[model samples]
Target: MTNLIRKLWVPVMTLMAITGMGQMPIFKRYYVADIPGLAWLGEPFTVHWVHYAGAAVLMFMVAVITIRWFADREPLTTSGTLRITLLALLICTGYIRVVKNLPDIHFSPTFTMLIDWTHLLFAMLLGVAALWSARTGRRSYTKQTESLRRI
Candidate 1:
């Protein structure tokens, strides 16, 4: 349970940071592929931002349960389990960028170059965060079970 709380803390904080960033207009019309692009009527930032926000909310609940488990000296709850599933989706999102789609937008070469660089940099950050969370989450489950068995 202590491990669970430790594992969930980073992801919850990351999700909160992502949501608090509000919508960054990274791509306007087209998506990086695989992810559904924005429609003519809707803005891309809003959709992407909402997805990240939803993920944060789900992670927040997981964090709450994990903290509770640690406090009560109980097993990590299903909230922790659900968070693992969400982490898998985040991994898939990273893979999608590698395979079917990389976001491209035609812009003034100077600005576009900077944008591309910035985007790739942020992508690396996200990839690292997602993998770390998944690995940590898995370890959390293992620790919980092992500890429970000792009792």
Candidate 2:
């Protein structure tokens, strides 16, 4: 389980964010439209499947990491902690938006827009952070390999 998580976390998060980001433009366009510009995407359940499914897996992974992090008794690294925090926040905002901004849900225009933009902003930041984290991990991996070769 630990090994699987270590290998798959970044890829999973990256893929989820990509799909979520891809869905955003359509979401925004049709969020308040009369004819519903994004009907081509799919029915509600189909469109939401990507978001909800990714979120479920992500939450499960986060729970696993949180348990392991506490169990290991290791010092928390700042970057790792920050990344986790951001990911959690992103998931939370995404959930709230899902509940609040649906076509059937009638929220104030300002409030709906706020949730939409908030979700987008968090998603963007999380994406950038994930990319940076992956790059940093690869650099360390390369450095270790080079040192091992020298040895």
Candidate 3:
């Protein structure tokens, strides 16, 4: 189960990142809508819904991984600590963005844009961190296997 989750980590993060990018107004107007079949992506609500759904999936995956890590008493390395910090900040910003989107709530345009930009920045950083973690994990696994073969 842990292995499966590890394998899925990168792909899921990539999907979430793409959907998040699609929500950007400029990206939608200049790129997404220009694509023939993907014109539907230009619809703000459609992209928002997809992003929300992806977030739910991501939350679940993170929860499971975190729980398993704690249960197994896994050692947290520096990169692991960084990933956790980024995920926590990302979740907080994402929640704020969703709340600010509600009809009853109104924030200043500047504040809203700040939140959006911060969320996007954290997401991009988190994606890079996840990719780096996966690459390093794979390299270490390969080294372990090679060492075992020689002995």
Candidate 4:
């Protein structure tokens, strides 16, 4: 179960990010409609709902993973710690963005843009870190297997 969740974490976050991007006015205005066969992605309202739904699922998954990791007393490597920190920050920024979007809330345009950009930056960093972690894990695994074969 934990292995499955770990495998899914990156792809699910990537999809959420993509759907979130689809809700951006600039993307909708300049790109979404122009792309053939993908025009439906420009529907802001639907995309917004989908993004929210994905966020909810993401939060749940993170909670479960964190709990399981602690319960199992898994050793946290530096990369694992970094990923957890990034995820925490990402979730914080995401919640702020959601609050800013509430009907009665009124953040300054500059503040809103700052939050949006920060969220995107965190997501990109997290994705790169995940890839790096996977690559390093594979390399170490290969080295271990090679040593075993030599023995």
For model 2, residues 1-151, the per-residue Cα lDDT tens digits are 9789878877777667656755655544655323456453434445557667777887888798778766755554566666667777887878887788577878788987887888788877867876786778721211223445698
Q: lDDT tens digits, residues 97-122, model 1?
A: 33332356334667555544554455
Candidate 3: residue 14 Cα off by (Å):
1.5
The C-alpha TM-scores of every prediction are: 0.32, 0.68, 0.77, 0.78
Q: Which stretches of candidate 3 lie over 4 Å from their true place?
A: 132-151
lDDT of 4 by residue, 46-129 (tens): 778888988988988888877876675645667777878888888999999999988999999999999999998888887788
Q: Which residue window of length 10 is worst by lDDT in model 3?
A: 138-147
- In terms of TM-score, the best-performing candidate is 4
- In angstroms, the error of model 1 at 125 is 4.6
Model 1 ranges with Cα > 4 A deviation = 1-22, 29-37, 40-45, 48-56, 59-63, 74-129, 132-138, 145-147
Off-target runs (Cα >4 Å) in candidate 4 are: 25-37, 138-151
Ranked by TM-score from best down, the candidates are: 4, 3, 2, 1
What's the lDDT for all of these models? 0.50, 0.67, 0.79, 0.78
The RMSD of every model to the true structure, in order and in angstroms, is 11.8, 6.8, 4.4, 4.7
Q: After TM-score superposition, what is the CA distance of residue 113 in candidate 3 from its true location, in Å? A: 2.2
- RMSD of model 2, in Å? 6.8
Rank by lDDT, descending? 3, 4, 2, 1
Candidate 3 local lDDT, 18-136, one digit each (tens): 67877877656678577788776788788789889888988888899778666756456677778788989999999999999899999999999999999988988977887797788
